[model samples]
Target: MGLGGTAKKIQTLAEKAEQTYQRLNDLREEVEKTQETVTETGDRVRQLETEMAEQRAVLDAVAEEVGVDLEAVSTDAHITEAESDDEADDAGDDGSADTDGDDEAVDDDS
Candidate 1:
């Protein structure tokens, strides 16, 4: 081959190699960014899980203090009924009940 043809071939090969190297470097950078994002997401997930566990523990402790059995208080209907009964008892004992019309009239003036 002529010297000019050989030089052209070498230049073409060099260009291809340089392109390949640039692509490889770009791919490495992308992988590193992906890994960093994944690690940050994992840490956030762990923090949220820990916060949820702590909140659950606080709720359990409050339930125990208030004489509430968490195992037994499973449904909204049961909670509503219990609250209604408590309110009825409190009203009955607080002299707020109008057993007769006279008691209501006395309350109306005040």
Candidate 2:
């Protein structure tokens, strides 16, 4: 009777140990999945940051190429060349020249 009782206790302990091991393995898998998610998220964030920086560089380059003063752009608006010339010509009603510095040669000798 004593030997049978001891064998039954051993069997129960073994079963409990197996259950604990399985739970530990499950926890390890969950931790690995979480780490992978974090890594992927980090990589995506870094990629976005790099792309933003590149876009900024391209914007700066384009602004320079087009002779845009970024600082003055917010405060001032400019008319097109044709509109400006027409306005200047209209303002110069006397047959002299436009005040915007586009002076035509007049026949002063006449």
Clashing pairs in 1: none
Per-prediction tally of clashes? 0, 0
Per-residue CA lDDT of model 2 for 1-110, tens digit only, reads: 99999999999999999999999999999999999999999999999999999998999899999998976764444445667877886776575453554445343322
TM-scores for candidates 1 onward, in order: 0.60, 0.54
- Which structure among the candidates has the greatest lDDT? 1
lDDT of 1: 0.88
lDDT of 1 by residue, 1-110 (tens): 69999999999999999999999999999999999999999999999999999999999999999999787777777899999998996677555465664766766765
Of the candidates shown, which would achieve the greatest TM-score relative to the real structure? 1
Residue 65 lDDT in model 1?
98
Model 2: weakest 10-residue lDDT segment is 101-110
Give the Å error, residue 50, model 1.
Answer: 1.1
